[model samples]
Target: MVKKMMQRILPRAFLGKPSLLRRSATASQSTLAQTVQENEPVLPKMPPFDYTPPPYTGPSAEEILSKRQQFLSPAVFHFFKNPLNLVDGKMQYLFDENGKRYLDAFGGIATVCCGHCHPKVVDAIVNQTKRLQHSTILYLNPAIADFAEALASKFPGDLKVVFFTNSGTEANELALLMARLYTGCQDVISIRNGYHGNAAGTMGATAQSSYKFNVVQLLMPSIHLTFISSFACVSKTGVHHAQNPDQYRGIFGSDGSKYARDVDDIITYGTSGRVAAFIGEAIQGVGGIMELAPGYLPSVYNTIRKAGGVCIADEVQSGFARTGSHFWGFEAHGVVPDIVTMAKGIGNGIPLGAVVTTPEIAKVLAHRSYFNTFGGNPVCTAAGHAVLQVIEQESLQQNAFTVGSYLKQRLTSLKDKYEIIGDVRGRGLMLGVELVTDRQLKTPAKVETLHLVDQIKDFLVDVMDYTLSKM
Candidate 1:
C-alpha cells in the first residue's frame, strides 16, 4: 500500500518539473537544429516547477501514540516501545509520520549502513521489482549465485558457501546448526552480555537476562551459555570506574585475567575436550558494543578449534562496512572464523540475512534439511548487491570511520564533561556510550539512559518541526 503511494507520488513529482530536465538532440536532429546540438546524448526534458513535497497529513505524534496503545502485539511488548509510524527515511534521517526527522545516530541499532533508503538501494529495489522477485532454491537463480559469488570473494579463504535467511537471528540459528552438525557436540561458549538472536534456538545461545527471562523455555536444550567478559572487562557488570589500561591484560590478573583462561579450562578440562562451537559477535551489539580484546577472539577460536569445535563470527550487527576501518569487524581483530553469520545492513534496509562458511561446514549443514523461503530472493539480492556497491562507491565505510570517530570524540568529550558516561567505546559506526550513576561504582543508570534517549528524540522533533514551519 505504501509502495503504491510512493510510485504514484514520485512519478508525478518527477514529471511536474520540466525545468529540472535537460534535453539532448539526436545526431541527425542536431544537424537540423543547431540550438539543440550540444553534443550530448538525446534525452527527454524535465518539466519546470520547483519540486514541492505533498504536505504530511498523517496523525500527530500524540494521536498516534494514543492509537498505538489500542493495537497491541506480542512483538511490541518485546521491544523498546511501540515502533514509530515512520513515514519516510533518507540518508541519516528517519522521518516520522508527521514529517519530523531524527538524526538516526544509532542507525536503528546500527542496521542501516549507508543510510535509510539510500538512493542506490531504492533504485535497485525499484528496478528489480520490474524484473524477477523470487525463485525457489530447489531451482537455480542467477542473481542468488551472483550474490553468493561476490559475497564469498570478499573473504580470505574457503569460507565461501553462502546461505541466505530473512534475518540475523535466523542466520545465527543456521550457523549454530552447522556447528553442531560438524562438531557432533552440544555445548557452545558465548561471551557475557553477547546477544545472538531472539528465536527459540538462537535465544539459548544469547547470554542476556532480558532476553532469557521472557523465553518460555530453553528451545535448544543442549546449548550452554557462559560469560566471557563484562562490558569493559570489569570484575562485575554495570558502571564501574576502571583505568583504561593501555596494555593487554592476560586472562589471569587481579581482574578476571583468567576469564578467558578459565573459559578455556572449562571447555577443555571441565567439558572433557568436547565442545560444539564458540559463537560470538565481532562486537557485542545489544550487549552494549563491547569490543573483544586485541587477541581475545583468535585465542578463543584457537582453543575451540583445538577442541574439535568450530568458531562462528555472528556479524549480524557488525558487518557490511559498518565498522569503518575494515569491512568486517573481525578483520580489525586479525582473526578469521570458520563461519560468518550476517544481517541487519546487508540489504541496506531490505529484509535479508546470510551465513557464509567454509565448504566443510557448509556441506555438513547442507546434509541437514535446511531451507529458507525468502532467502536470497532475486530482488533482495539485487538490493543487497546495490547496497554493497554503494558503500564502496560512496566511501560510506570510510565515512563511518571518519564521521564515527568524530562522533566518538564528541561523545568522549561529553563523557568527560558529564559524570554519567561510564565508558565510551566502539569501532567505526558501531559505537556505544555506557551510562553510570557513579563513576567509581559504575551502576547502570537505566532510568537516566532512557531519559536521555527520550530527550534526544524530543529535541529532534522540536528542531525538525521548527525547520519545516519556516519552509
Candidate 2:
C-alpha cells in the first residue's frame, strides 16, 4: 500500500522489487571472454528460459534520474555511470526501459530465491491481498502462524519460535535485544568485515567502515539530527568485532582455530568475560563473498557460549537455500545458532525478515510488549509461505548446489589463468571474484577492476573471473 501510494505521489519513482540495472554494454565486453585462461577456457552457455516479459513502455532512464536527483536522498546510488531504468522482471531475467533483456545473477542480492515475481509467490500475494492485507499481530492470522511454523520446522534444535520484521535491520535489532535480555550482558561480538544492518545496534555491530557513518555521537543532537534525523547510526559502544576468519586475506591465514583464539582473547581481556551475543554471517556476502575459514564457526560458537553469549547467525544473504548445500548458511558450519536472523530470500523479492530462536530464549520478550505494525502482514507472510513452497517444489536448493558448483569450479580455473584473480570464494550462487595486481602480495587492482566493471557493468552474464576491492 505504501509503495503503491508512493507511486501515485511520485510518478515513475519505482515499483515492485527494486532494480539494480545498468545500460547494455558495448562490444568491448568481448575483452572478458578473450581475457580467459591459458587453456583457452570457454564461457558456459546460459540455460535457456522459455518465457518472455511483456513489452515495457515506461519513463526513460534520463527522466527517472532527473526526478530521483530532485526528490530522493543524495546518498542513494546505483551501479554504472548511466544507471538502467528497469521496468519488468520474470523469473531470473530483467527488462530495461527499452525492453532489452538481461539475465539476473546477483539474484537481487540473494533475495530472488524463487526468482523475480515467481508465479506461485505472485499468486499467493495477490490472493492474500484480495482477502486481507494488514491486521497486525493483535488478531489471529493463519498466514503468519502457518508460515512461522513452516520456517521454524526448517531450523535445527529448539529454534522453533519466530518473530517477524520488515527488514534485516529490524530482525537483527530484535535479535540483539533478545540476546542482551537472555544473557543479561551488554557486550556483543560480531565478525570483522560482516554487515548486519544500518540501524543503531546493528550498524555498531557491523564491522565494515564503508557501511557506517560518523555523527554517531548520540549526545550531539544537532549533528545526529543532521546525520539521520532522530536515529543514531554509529557507535560500537558495547560491540566487539572479532577478527575475521578469512582464509585468503586474514592475518591468521587458513588456520581457523588460530582466528577463533582471537575471540577467546577478546572475552578474556575485553569486557567482564560476559557477552550478550556473537553474530556472524557464515559467508560474508557484503565483504566480497568471503566465507568464514573452515572450522572457524564451531570453535567461535563454543567460545561465545562459554562466555555466556548467544550465537546469532545473520543469514540475510545466505539463507533460504541460497547456500545450496544447506538450508541455512550456519548449517554448513556444523553448529546450531541460538538465534537466527534472516531476510533477503525469505519472501522472494518482498520486504520481509524474521528472527527465529528457541522458545525458552524467546520468552524474554514477554517482559515487555513488543510489536511490529507491518512485520508479518498477511500478504508478506503469505508470499513468504509461497516462497518456501516454491523452493521445495522446484528443489531450488539442489539446483543451486549443482549450478553453483559448476560456476565455482570454472572460476577457480580462471584464478589459475589470470594472476589478477586473487581469490574465488563463497558458496552456492552467493559467490565473489576478488582481483589483485600481484598474486604473491595480493595487491588490490582497484583501477583495473573499475575499468572492467565500466566495460561490462550489469550486462555481464555467465561470469567467472574479475573484480578488485569492489571498493
Candidate 3:
C-alpha cells in the first residue's frame, strides 16, 4: 500500500525509469538556471520602492487593437507593430497585459511627470471626487484658487494671474488672445519646428505641415478677428514661421545671435513692424525634443518686445520640474517671458492646463465675459495640487537632475560608439536621440530609427519572458 501510494504521488517517468526522470528534470532546471544567469545582468535593478503593479486580467492586445480599430478614430496611431496593451503604470514604468513591465521612457509623450497613478495624486483625486466632483469656474471653488496660488509661486517676474484650461492648446489660445488684446496687434511669430497646439487658434501658430489641416485655413476666418475684419489686416493675425535655431542642422551652427537675426528680418520683411506675440517652446517637445540655441530666447525676446510682441514661453512639455536644472525651461535660457503656457505635467495626467501672466496682462480677458465649464474642476485642481506637493516632497526635481545627467552621459557614450547617432540633445528628463545617415549632411536615418525601436522591443520581450519563467 505504501509503495503504490509513493508511485502514484511521483512522476510517471520515475515509476519505471528513475534515471530518465532525474536526467529530464535536471536538464530542464539547468537550462532555466543558465538562461536566467545569462540574462540577469541585462535586467535593470528596480529602485528601492515598495509599490508593485496589480495583476492584469484584461483583454489581450489583439482584442484591444481590434476594438480600437472599430471604435476609435482612424487618426489614432500606435507605436510598435505589436502594440503594447498597457494596463497599469507606476513611477517611470508601465505594465502591459500578462504583467510585462516596461520602462516608460517617453513618459506618455512628456505628459506623465510625477508618474502614472502616483499614490498621493490618486488619493487627492479620489478625495476631491468624493467631496465634490464638478463645479464651474464662475462659482467659488477652493480647489481652483488653491491650485492657482500654488502654481503661481513657481513662476518668476509678475506672472501671478492664472487662467485654467483643459489642454495646452487652450492655454496657448488664451495666451495668444491675451497677447493680441494687450498689444493690440495681430501677427504672431513661432519657430519653424516648434509645435504650439492643433486647435483652430493655435493651428496657425503651429508650422508643421503634418499637423496642419485644410480646415485650419477655413477656421481662421471665424477664429481670428483680424483675418475677417480689415483692421491693419496687412499682417492679418497671420502666424509667421521663423527659422528654427537648430544647432545640429541649421544654417547657423550654434550661433544663437545669428538665429535671432532671422527673427528681426522676419519682423522687418514678413509682418507689420508690430506683432502680437512671439511664442515658442523652450525645448520643442513635439519637434523631436529640440533645444533652442543659447542666447536665442533673450535676443528674440528683446526683438519681439521692441516690436510690441510679448514673449510667450510654451512650457507644456518642459515645465513642472521636467527640465531638472530649473523649475521652468525658460530659466535655463536665462530669459523671462511675459506669458507662460503650461499643461501635461501640471496635473500629472489629469486634464488641466494653465496660462500664467501678470495681473495687468491677464486683465485683457476680464474686459469681456469669459468662462470655462470644466476648467479648474475640483478633481483636476486637487490632483494638480497633489502633484506640486509630490514633486517637492519626493525631491523629484533633484532626481530629474541626478538621473537625467547620468542618462545623458550614457547616451553621449552611445553616440560616441554609434555613427548613426547624429545628435543627443535636450535638458534633464526631456531628452532626444536623433539618428542620421551621414554625420556631415545629417540626413535623418528613419529606417535605422525604426530598426532600433524594433530591437529594443525584442530585447524587452526577451527580458520579460525570462522574468516570467523565473516567477
lDDT (10s digit) by residue, model 2, range 419-442: 456888888878888877667788
Name the runs in model 3 displaced over 4 angstroms: 1-52, 216-233, 458-471
TM-score of each: 0.77, 0.84, 0.86
Q: Which one is best on TM-score?
A: 3
* lDDT of model 3, residue 263: 91
The deviation in Å at residue 64 for candidate 2 is 0.3
Query: 313-410, model 1: which lDDT tens digit per residue?
Result: 98999898888998898898788889999998898778899999988778885565877888988888988888888987998888888867866776
Highest-lDDT candidate? 3
Model 3 TM-score relative to the real fold: 0.86
Backbone clashes in each candidate structure, one number apiece? Answer: 16, 0, 0
Estimate the overall C-alpha local distance difference test score of candidate 3: 0.79
Ranking by TM-score: 3, 2, 1
| lDDT value, residue 409 of candidate 2 | 75
RMSD of each predicted structure:
16.3, 10.7, 11.5
Worst 10 residues of 1 by lDDT: 232-241
